[model samples]
Structure formats: C-alpha cells, structure tokens
Target chain A: MQITTFSFKRLLIYPVILIILLVLGFTVTAEKQPAWFQQAQDEAEQDGYKLITAHEMKALYESGENFTIIDVRPEYEFREGHILHANSLEFDLGDKLELKSDKQAALIGLLGSDKKQTIIFYCRSVA
Target chain B: MGYQNVLRFPDGFFGWKSFFSDNTQSVDTIKKLGIGDVFPSCRLVMLYDETDRAYLKIQSLQKSFALEDIGNPYLYIVIYNEKCLACVDEVQSFKALYKSLNESLYLSDKVKLLAIGAGSKKRGVIAFKKENAIPYPLFADENRSIFYCLGNPVLPTSYLVHIQPDGRRQILFVQQDHINNVEMLIQKIYSLVKDMELPK
Candidate 1:
C-alpha cells in the first residue's frame, strides 16, 4: 500500500512540476517578445484580424485560392516590384487607426459587396 | 469594417521582395530622365487643392490638371507615393522648402511647388493631404500614367524645371533621392534660380 501510494504521488508531483515548467517556459517566451510586437498582436486579436507569415502567404498564393491580396504600399514601390497578382489599393490610416470615410467607401467598392471574402493587406512592415 | 475574414501579412512587401530577390528584374527598364529633357505632359486628377479646385467636370467632381497649366517660371515637381513613409518625409521637406521660397522676394513668385501622387487615388490623396497639412496642390495619378510617362523613376523623385517662355519645360535638376539636408536643397534651388534672368 505504501509503494502504491508513493507511485501515485510521484506521478502527480511529476506532472505538476512539468506543468509549472511548461507554463514558465511559455511566460518567458512571451516576455521575450518586443513591446511593439506584443501590442500589434493584442491589437490584431482585438480587431479580429489574423496575422499570417510570409511562407503561409506564399502557400496561399500558390494554392490558386479565390482570396484577394491587397498591397497597401506606395504605388512607386508596387511599380518597382510586388508579389504577382496582388492588387494595389493604397489608403492612408487615419489618426485613430481607422480608414477615412471615402477610403472606406473605396475599399468597400474594391472589395465588392462580399463581406465573406478573404482579404489580405500588407505594406512595408508589420506596423 | 464588417469583413470577418480579414488577414494581415506581417512580413509585408519587404519580406516578399527578399524571398524573391533572385527573381527580381533590373531597374534599367525604366529610362531615367536627365537634365534638359522636356517634362512630359500628362493629365493628373487633382485630388486636393489649398486655393481652388480646377474641376474638369462640374457634375462628376472630377478635377484634372496638367503640368503645363501652372505658368510659374520655375516649377518644383515632387513625385511621391501616398503610403510611402519616406515619401511623406520628402513631401514635408519640400513643404518647408516651399514655405521658405514663398517668404523669399526673388524665388517666391517664380517658383511653384507641386506634388504628384504616384498610383494614389482620390481618397488616398485627400487623406494624405489632410494628414500632412500640405499647403500646395496635390494630384493623384491613379493609373500611374504620369509615373510611367516620367520613366517610372524612384519614389519622391523631385524635378526642378525651368519653364521657358516659348512654353517648353527644361528639367534643371533631378533629385533621385530623398532630401536629407533641406537647407542645402534650398540653397541649391536659390543659387539655380537667382542667377537666371527671368523672362520679362
């Protein structure tokens, strides 16, 4: 009975320790991120927008999907070079991090009347 | 605003450019305009103006303006991209230069500052103008027609043109880079314009 109880305690204690270590590892990793990146991630989460990686974007582009890829960079940059098939729709972000009314309208117009469409926007950087 | 499936690529264009750097084409395809080249005439849709709106159609509210319309002897044209941060800095620098030029007795009347938004649309240009508080006129080249006509030069490319009396524009200096030193640029413009005999 003593040995069995000891094994059970060992199992429980080992998982608890492992769990604490895992949590600590995750916390440390999160803390290591830059403040700007954390803010961006939080804002994206709140805004319900998903963040994608370059490799993921490339994969999506190659998938021949029906999604829309919008390049929000300046026209000159787009002209010099850009991802193939990406549409150029330049719009300035307002002080409140919102699109101007007219720009919103233009965006809607370009996006057509479909709200369910998968639209991706990119510029010079994450910011 | 209700787009449920919106996504953002954090890597952006720079990442894409880097990944495909090997596939990048040469910039030699764009013919860089040199001094003395006649500034080509291309119709740009006027998006925002501080003074007056040169409306092309009263009903459509589609205002247009050409480089030739400005009768100023020395025209400083800055081609920029509305979303480009560097271009914004360049535009602000030009704005400061324009203000200084306006204050000057000799260069004020002879010079006119103009900005062309390469591949920018009406809404984008309007927002940019309002954000920058630009005093001069800003036009939108939605289709990049003017940009292509000017040999698709680099962003924020500035051209100082001497408009001849015979209605010809001679490119005096082409600044293919950003204005790092505004004072130097001002002095450069002043020296270039001060010695020239104004067409009387």
Candidate 2:
C-alpha cells in the first residue's frame, strides 16, 4: 500500500493530539464546587453543629431552653409576623453587608456583652 | 452527607389542622407583590453568597425578605405551616416559641396581606397552587441553592415577589417554618427588600 504525505502525517499525529485533548478536558470537568462550599459544609459536620428545623425550634421553646433567635430578614418584614421572640438581623440575599461594625453592635444590642448565650441563628432556610 | 440542618414538612401550616387551628390566623392585609409585567432589575436580588451570610447584625431574621414598596405599596403575608412549625408536644404554643424570631409580614403600610397559606406542600398545592405561582416558588430547595443564597429557609419557604417603591420588581417576603423555614422566611424577606432599595 502506498501512503501519501498528507495521510502519513495525519496517521502519526492524530492519536497524540487526541490523547492530549482528553487529558485537558478531564482536568477542567473535575473542578466543580468552590472551595468555600466544602469548607462550610465540613465545619458544620466536624463541629457537631446541627441545623434545627422550625418544628425543632418550637420544641426548644416548648422545652423552655434559653436561647436567642436571630431573624435575618428585613426590618419591615420583621414587624409583620416574626417568630414570637426572634430578633431582627436584616440583610439582603444577594448583597453583602458590612459586618465589621454590625457584628459589634449586634452583640452589644442582643446579648448585652454576654457572648455566652446560646445564640441560635436562623433565616429562611438551611442555607 | 449529614443533612442535619434540613427538615421537610412539605405541608407548612394548613395541613396540621388541629394544633394550628388556634395558632393560625389569616390576615386580610397581605397584598400581592411585584408588577404584572416583566421581572424587575437584578439589583434587588441582594443575596449574600459567602461564608458570612449570617454575619449581618440586624435585629430580626424576618428583615431578609420584606420590603416597604413606597409608591405602589404591596403586602406580603408569612404563612406558617403547622406540621413544619413545631415538634408537636415539645414546642408549646407556637406564639410562645421565639422571642426574637423575625417575621417581616407584620411590618405593614407599605404592603398588604392578600392571603396567608401554610401546611404541607401536598395540601398547599390545592390551596396556594391556584394563586398563580407559575414558577411555583416553594422553599424546598432540593439542591439547597435557594437556602444557600438566602442564608436559611427556616420559616416561609418562599417569598411572594413584588415591586418596590423605586419601581423594581423583587421578592416581597415568605412565611417559613424550617420544615423548610416556613415562618422565618417573612423576616428574611423584609431584609432582602430593604437591601434592594439600598443605595448602590
């Protein structure tokens, strides 16, 4: 069989090119969730933290466990129909607020310099 | 995968009839949210997509979702799903539960109460499904994306979208409980709405 120069080069390089492309594709596809997500999820699990449900929260109230309820919604909405005693922690879902000052103010305002309180923070869901 | 922070009451408040009977009250002041036209600008989607989602120092959890639409006021009601509200006996009176739990639905004058529905998703479908929730926005985010963005879906699964005073379409607020955050959602709504109105 006679091999033309064009076909000859195609045969020699095609396999190598294909192999290289596949390697690159595999690397990119493997990277999915951001590192922060894994970190948050891991921290929650390792620390034995639990995400309480609304019903569970109700139980705590029924049990009369002393704890703070943080309502991380808007000010106006807080006035509407908030949990019995949950405090307001107004925030935007897509926007980031300045926590540097808010945190200090919040601690003083809610706990009154007492960081030992069993502060249970809850928003709209288990985000 | 420890889904510790997850709970599913599917039915919010409307389903747990007996217990919720005395606890639940439908408000007529709740109003419809959002403009009838296209969805508003993206600025109002003031979501916190970081590790510090709950770092805000606001006083109420309900603030995250409610808004005081100035020009054309809209009302949003937070529907507390019964089964989702408590663990039956352990949680005494729903009213005696939280001293600080924020629910944005109570803040009014800017919005009105069209109606409030709670219970299981199964029953809510028959009750709230006909309210024209096309994208049937419920709080049950199987992927956890919705909760991740909103900080948590404790009470009030999802907020009813509404237009703000600035003429931008946005989510009004929700009534979450955390079975999927049934009642607390309204609190989140208020904050989210104000964030939308924030200057830049």
Top lDDT prediction, candidate number: 1
**Which candidate's DockQ is highest?**
1
TM-score for predicted model 1 compared with the true structure: 0.54
Separate DockQ for every predicted complex = 0.30, 0.02
Per-model RMSD to reference: 9.7, 21.7
In angstroms, the error of model 1 at A89 is 13
DockQ value for model 2: 0.02
**The 10-residue segment with the lowest total lDDT in model 1 chain B:** B52-61
Which residue runs does candidate 1 get wrong by more than 4 Å? Answer: A1-127, B1-28, B45-63, B198-200
> B56-127 in candidate 2: lDDT tens per residue?
222333313323322334434233332332322212222222212223333443433322223234344333
Fraction of native Cα contacts kept in each candidate? 0.62, 0.01
Residue A122 in candidate 2, Cα distance off native in Å: 1.3
Chain B alone vs. reference chain B, TM-score for every model:
0.76, 0.26
